[model samples]
Target: MHSLPPLAALKAFFVACHAGSYTAAARELYITHGAVSRHIQVVEKWFGVNLFIKQGQRRVPTPYALTLARELGGAFDTLSDIALRYGNGGRNNVFNVSVPTTLSLKWLLPRLDDFYARFPDANLQISTANTEQLHIIGHYDLLIRRETSGTEYSAIPFLQDHHCLMASPALLKRHAIERPIDIFSCPRIETLTRPGQWNLWLKAAGLDKSAGNGIRRYDHFHVSLHAMLEGIGVGLGPINTLSQEISRGNLQPLFAKITVAPNQYYALTPVGVQKTLLHRAFEDWLVSQGQRDIKLADLPL
Candidate 1:
């Protein structure tokens, strides 16, 4: 560590590379572009190499810069997490959760009345975003994600289901889905933002590849579900989220055999957070209820 680059310069280089621009990185750090540039220059000088390649108007990072960026990004995020955890000297009973909006709305939201009933003293907050930003891992007490695994905490397999082609009774009746092959004559299927999901679901239902053409797609499941709920068209999506509507006779499942989605439901939290009584009771209840739907070794759908 005798002749190391200045920490500021190192940090600036990391931010610039990670953010893909000196200006954006500077804005995040609340500093001048000149200051960030100077720091990058200092780091480059100390390394005796170029960290970034200038192309016409764009700043492209070199191979060396990419590797360092991730480490520094993690470092900065870790520091932020620690700062917030220590800074918050709040009541012990407060709990926070984050989940994707569609999952929260369809499965978790309608269901949280029970959690509150079980742990009346605990205050709960839920956020609905899928990505685990570094700050969130430290801030949120529990996070619901549709992922294959968990990172730092224990993961509970909450709910599992396959993607089903479904639509409002109003739409299906008009379109008339008498068989899987009949889908081609109907309105194009809708899906969450994930690419190729419609094609996969159609193929699973034994329809020909021609059946997959011209399918409309959206990124968020909420959008797709909303489209289906409003009688827009058939949608390929999770069964659990659409359960209530189907039960209410407002929607109809096109096929009972669904195409599997890679991610089911997972509970993520830091180590020991679930052990707390506030979280424990809710976790136990949630898992027991979910077990009725999901089993690890068997084919889930």
Candidate 2:
């Protein structure tokens, strides 16, 4: 038996705690910051416990509050699941999906028009935070991420972000490059922000050195890709990540034979658990789209 907290207050509390900022929580909840603050205080007064410690502008959760918060979050997720399953007639399918920026922009958004056109009733909420921050298994209804664990979901292999040595043709043509060892000893090496990506790629590609010197890092893929596109330096990027550019003649691969990176883009489906029709439809449609793209990408490499 659960003693129900005030629905509004609990909602506010969950958002505030999850977000770690009342103002941010208010924006997500579509209410004013004062309302969120009032709701939390109301809950605190009702329970005779302090849930938040105000340190200047930040709200720190007390130990009790943190435990309560986890419970509250679990409760909300359960209620959300119930609402998604039974609140409407196969519609009201608001599915929350967690995805990486690389897939979100390049792949998912481009194919989403069909989904919207077919199932206009389904509403989708996409969380754009990197997979490193959000638990793909914990909260989201679906996650399209680089396949790390493989057992995370229904297990669609989808597309491989194959690691490759790519650079602008001008850079390659100017420098004589025959062996993998040639990449290092260059002036600058452009690489992505992922942890150990550059070093690991170099090592996996059978390069001479693992770390130390000849490495320039960029926080975003676009920045690194742009540097490579402008003929600045060599970039070790995914095969699929460079496919579009290669087609457009903006970039070229150094080696024809590629390695499906130790990492890959993956799609996870939350099926079997009852959900909104929109969610199910979107999941099915996404898989269908992935199937369709495989045919489109049968380009001669």
- Best by the TM-score measure: 1
In candidate 2 the C-alpha lDDT for residue 285 amounts to: 77
Task: List the candidate 2 regions with Cα displacement exceeding 4 Å.
Answer: 8-46, 50-90, 114-122, 132-138, 148-152, 169-207, 210-213, 219-223, 226-231, 258-264, 275-301
Point out the worst 10-residue segment of candidate 1 by lDDT.
Answer: 292-301
Which sections of candidate 1 miss by over 4 Å? 1-92, 130-138, 148-151, 212-214, 272-274, 292-301
Clashes of each: 3, 0
**What is the Cα-based TM-score of model 2?**
0.62
Candidate 1 lDDT score at position 122 = 63
What is candidate 2's lDDT per residue for 1-301, written digit by digit as tens? 8886689998888778778888889999999988998999989998899999987978866778878988877777777766784577745556778877766765677667878788776678877754454354346777776654544456565665556677788887787767667776454555446556665566666765544465667777767776877777887766664555666777777664544344555556655545556655676676566555322235433
Candidate 1: the clashing residue pairs are 99-128, 193-218, 193-219
Give model 1's TM-score versus the native structure: 0.63
Error of 2 at 218 (Å): 3.6
